[model samples]
Target: MKKDSTMKRVLKLLKPYTGFIILSLIFALGTVISTLMIPVLEGRAVDHIIGKGKVDFSGLLFVLKEIAAVAAVTFFCQLFMNLINNHITYSVAKTLRQRAFERLLRVPVKVIDSESHGDIASRIVTDADSFTDGLLLGFTQLFTGIMTIAGTIIFMIRIRFTIALIVIAATPVSLLIAKFISGRTYRYFTQQSKDRGDLTEYIDERISLEDLVSQLGAGELSKEEFVKKNNKLTDSATKATFYSSLTNPSTRFVNAVIYAVVGVVGAFLAVAGSISVGELTSFLGYAREYARPFNEITGVITEMQNAMACAARIFEIIDQDQVEDCDGEFDGEVKGAVDMEHVDFSYVPEKPLITDLNVKVNPGEKVAIVGPTGAGKTTLINLLMRFYDVNAGSVKVDGRDIRTVSRNALRSRFGMVLQETFLFSGTIRDNLTLGKPDATDEEIIEASKAAHAHEFIRKLPDGYDTVLSPSGTLSQGQKQLLCIARLMLALPPMLILDEATSSIDTRTEMKIQDAFNKMMKGRTTFVVAHRLQTIRDADMILYMENGHVLEQGNHKELLAKNGYYAKLYRSQFMS
Candidate 1:
């Protein structure tokens, strides 16, 4: 995106706070006016002191008092301006983060799946902070700097037009220097921001899987990779800082030269009786004041460039294409009868994963999908849940096309338990009641008992109130049981269990299987299992390979046919 367009978008976000901004600008003007009066008052005081005996003590006292009063006003106005600027900067940052998060929630699942989770997080949290810092600089320094520069120019011209023109003529040198350095620094800062996000992503992944790395004896390899990413970030940051740092000194050098020329000319004018000594002193002060804004603004050029880069990244998320949702509403209850007609789907167009798939499941039947890795078992679940729309054909729930229904309405009918379980940082009761927030204590205990998780819960220090995190002490099997208990509490009409009991021991698995059998009695359930024995009672068992359902039947039926299903079953038990 072009820099001007990106900045325009950022300013649009600030439109809501226009009233605060106007008030701050008013305070800034007061600060500049009061500050400009100080130099003039000090010059008058200087005029009162001619010779040791000729000093006008009374006049000096009066001028000093006026300077003191103006200084106090300047301080208060500046304080209020700073307070308002802080409020606006942080508020804008808060709004940006909220919008980014909302956009993340609405974007297509594929968008999230394609990007690094940590990189997305960095754009929201880290990038937003950097942008706000730059914005604060703009509000605090840039606005006031412009006002001060203009005030000083007016004051200087009133004192001596010839020297004032000299100051004005040199303004372009400082601006040109700042512009040249700032332009070169932007690309480096952009690269630095990108590298920082990449490093953050790598670190997040490695830190989350540190245990796995240790177990697999890949610690050294992980460290080497991290070092490479870190070095890349370091290099980019070094180059960006080196270039941006030039703006301040380069502009300051030009301003210093202009100040020297003003001092020499003003001195000659005072000697030639063109201006009073006190007036010459005041003019020099105004010249210094004029140069100060340029120095300060150029000094902040680095932060401004970085802020633009980060803002661009944050807008990338806010501007993503959202998942298309239908406005059609479903009126009646979902009975869990599902059908997929001539379904075709693929992540990539050239590599089709599932094609010409047709399946019909009754309202309360248990269907078991058994397949090798990457055989599209999980894709089937994604389709049923409408996580991804099929390339061709439609999936129907209770004779109504699912694509016509709102996504939330369609998904509310099903419950899922996957092989990888998730437990947030909250109490056990909190995690259990996620699906049904209004569940009573008795209902919670009953569900926990059904999933065989109650016995272990009773032994914990706080039982249902025990806090759990993803890295909590609970074993994988324990977490899976908690997930199952959560589902039991909600008891949706349909269920999808993808290797749901894979982490448990055979004994505990058998107990959970009993609980599952009871739960599956009247609910339409789709089970993806690797253990053939666990799915023996399924009404229909699908043996899938390379996205095709090669054989499907009951235990005795498929065994009798001695086809693909039988061979897989024999290989599992017979081996």
Candidate 2:
């Protein structure tokens, strides 16, 4: 992205606080003016003491009191300026975080799946941290530095145009140093931010899959990989720091040159009749005041580069195209009939998952889809839910093209229990009632009983109110049962069990099968199962192979046909 774009986007976020910024600028102007006037007053006091060739006690006292009053006003103005600047900084940070989070909610599932959770999270957390820190310092330095520079130059020209030329000549040296250093380091800083995000993602993945890594004896390998990523981040950060470090000392050297030129030239001018001793003293003071902040400005420049990099990442996510709007508005009740006509899709367009697939189901039929791993089983579920759109053809519900239906309305009819169960960090009651927000306690208990989860839930310390985290101590089967119970309460007109009973033992599977039988009574159901036992009684069984419906019939009919279904069934149970 262009640097201007990044700058403009950040400024756009700050645009709403124009009035506040103006007020800050006013305060800042007062502080700078008050601060500059002090040296002038001090110079005049020096002139008075020397011109008299004796200490003028009362005159000195009045000068001292005037300087104190100006200093006091400068202090208050500086305080108010910082307060306003801090408010803008923190306000921008808060608003940026909110917008990014809201975009996270509205972003497509495809985008979410493509990006790691940690990278997105870093944009919200890590990037925001740098942004808040950098911006707080950036705006504060920028306003004060600009005002001080302009004010000093104007005052310096009035005092001595020749000395003023020296400061002006040295000014670009500081700017050029800042520019050159920032240019060299911006890319490294950007890379460092990305590498940091990758590290966060890696850590989260490692922790979540700790048991699997250890069980597979890949712990050392994973650690090596982590080290590699960590080194990349460290290297990028080192390079950024190294380049940015050059700015301050280099600019401070130019600052020293400016001071030297002013001193040497001012001494001659003071000796000759060209400038007064007091005027020369004030000019030197103004030069120091003007040049000192380049040191601070250079520091701000380093941080600004980092902040701009972070802001770019944030804008990248915020600027992503949102999910396609599901057009048309319909409140018609879904009767649960679904169809896929010549449907085709691929997560990657060059590698197809499903092609020319056609299927039909009546309003309340029990349908089972049996397939091997990677046979596009889950992809079918994604399509049906419109979590993704088909690259070609269409999936229809109740003879209406789903593409024409609003996503929320179409998805409202489906309640799914997947092989991988996910529970949010919340009370059991919260997870259970997600599908039916108004589900009463009695209804929740009944649903839990139907899914065989109530007995264990009641035995827990808090029963339905037991809070659960994603990494909570709940057993795999227990979590699955809770997921089932949650869906049972939902009781959508259509039901899906995608290897939902994988973790359950034979005895518990049988019990859940009974519950599934009860749950499937009034709903149009779809089951994707590896265990043949769960779907033996499905009204229609589809045997899929390599994304195609190779054969399909009732269980007995498929077995009678002596096809893949019968072979798959025997492979699991006949031994």
Candidate 3:
């Protein structure tokens, strides 16, 4: 999108704060009005002493009193405006942050996977911060500069038209300089923001893969790559700052030249008797007044350009297409039956993954899906949860199509335990309540016990109240157990274990399996695992290969058939 259009959209986000914005404008106008009175009073005082050749003490005192009054009012106006502006800006930042986070929740899983974590984080934090700063300070300055210039010009013309004309004529030169620099600055800053996002993504990827890099002895190579990215970011930022910094100084220089010219002309006119000394003094004062705001106008333009660059990035995320949820109401509870007919799917259209596949699970049935790596095991679970819709065919829950039910209702029906566990930076109790926010302390302990995590949790100094940061104080298995405890508390009608025991030791896996057996009663279960031993007791087993079902039946039936399932079992058991 063009820069102007992007900025317009950002300004639209400020609609909710219109009251504060109006208050700011009123204060800004008051400030300018008060400032204008200072020069008028000074010019009058000069006229009384120099032109009249007499001093009126009372008149002098009156002018000084007026100047003092204007000064006081101006200060108060600025103070009030600043206070309101800060509040409005904070509100705007909060709204944008919430919208971005909610978008993440609604976006398709594929969309989230396609973007790097660091880039997304930068958009949320860095870009949003920039937008807030710009909207608050930039808007205030821009509005004040324009209003001051307008009011100052009117007053200058009323005092002396020729002098006003000179100032007006010089205005275009300053604008031209500002306009040229602002364009370049805006483009460079946009590039800088993009580079920053890239750098952030690179750092995030490396940090997350630190152990892998160490094991492969690629630390030096990674460091070199990081340096390269870092240098590019530095270069981009320098260029952006160079252009933006030039604008203010360049504006000031042009205004200085204009000031010299205006002063010389006004002095010549006063000596030649074309204008009085008092008028000339006032004109010169107005000229400087005019120049100051013009200088400010140029600076505001540069800042606005930079702010818009940030806003474009923030709005890009906000404007991304969101995943479509089911439109119909689904207030009733869901049965555990799930059926997929001739489902075909692919992350990219050019490379198909799951094709022409059909699967069905009866209510309260235990079904195990055994497949090799990249055989679409997790993809099936994602589809069932409506994280991504199938390219072809339909998924039905109970008797209704899944598409006819709201996403919240569909997802709320199942409890999922992924291989990689993620815990927030919070207390153990806080993390457990995520699955069921209203679960009581007693219920939380019960669920933890069921997942075999209660004993270990009790060993902690504060147990449920122990504070935990994201990067501190938990083993991988312990985190997984915490997630399991969460799932147990949810007590959904259906359960999905997607390689849930892949990270645990054999003994712990056996214990978790025993816990799973107890939890599986009266629940529809779908177990996706690489370990054949884990699924041997399932009521039904489906061996999948290249999106096709190669074998299906119980362990004994598949072994007697001596098909793909039997071969997979023999290979694992024989080892």
Q: What is the C-alpha lDDT of each candidate?
A: 0.91, 0.89, 0.85
In model 1, which runs have C-alpha deviations exceeding 4 angstroms? Answer: none
Residue-wise C-alpha lDDT for candidate 3, range 1-575, written one tens digit per residue: 58979867777877878888898999999988888778888887776675355787788888888889989999998889888888987788888888888888877778788888788898889987877877776666777788878888998889778878888888898899998888888888888888899999998888888889999999999999999999999999998888888888998898898889888988898889987777777777777877888777777777677678887877777788998765675546666888889999988899999888888888888999987877788888888888888899999888678888788888888899999888899999999998799999999999999888999999999999998887667888888899999999998999999888777778877888898998888899999988888888898888888777888888899999998888888898886
Model 2 residue runs over 4 Å out of place are 48-53, 272-277, 327-331
The collision pairs in model 1 are none
Separate clash counts for every candidate = 0, 0, 0
Clash pairs, model 2 backbone: none
TM-score of each: 0.98, 0.95, 0.94
Better structure of 1 and 3 per lDDT? 1
Model 3, position 93, has a per-residue lDDT of 82
Clashes, model 1: 0
Which scores better on TM-score, 1 or 2? Answer: 1
Residue-level lDDT of model 2, residues 1-575, one tens digit each, is 77689999898999999999999999989999998998798888787776545878788889889999999999999999999999999999999989888887777899999998999999899999898999999878888888998899999999988889888987887898889888888898899999999999999999999999999999989989999999999999999999999999999998998899899999998898798888988998898899877888899999999999998898888887887776665557777888999998989888888889999888888999987888877888899988899989989888888889778877778999999998999999999999999999999999999889999999999999999989998899999999999998998999888988998878988888888887888789999988888788888898887788888799999999999999999999997
Q: Tens digit of lDDT per residue, candidate 1, span 162-256?
A: 89999999899899889988988878878888898898999899888988999999999998998999999999999999998888888888888
The most accurate candidate by TM-score is 1
Q: lDDT (0-100) at residue 352 of candidate 3?
A: 93
Query: Which parts of model 3 have CA positions greater than 4 angstroms off?
Result: 48-58, 273-278, 327-333
State in Å the error of residue 389, model 1: 0.5
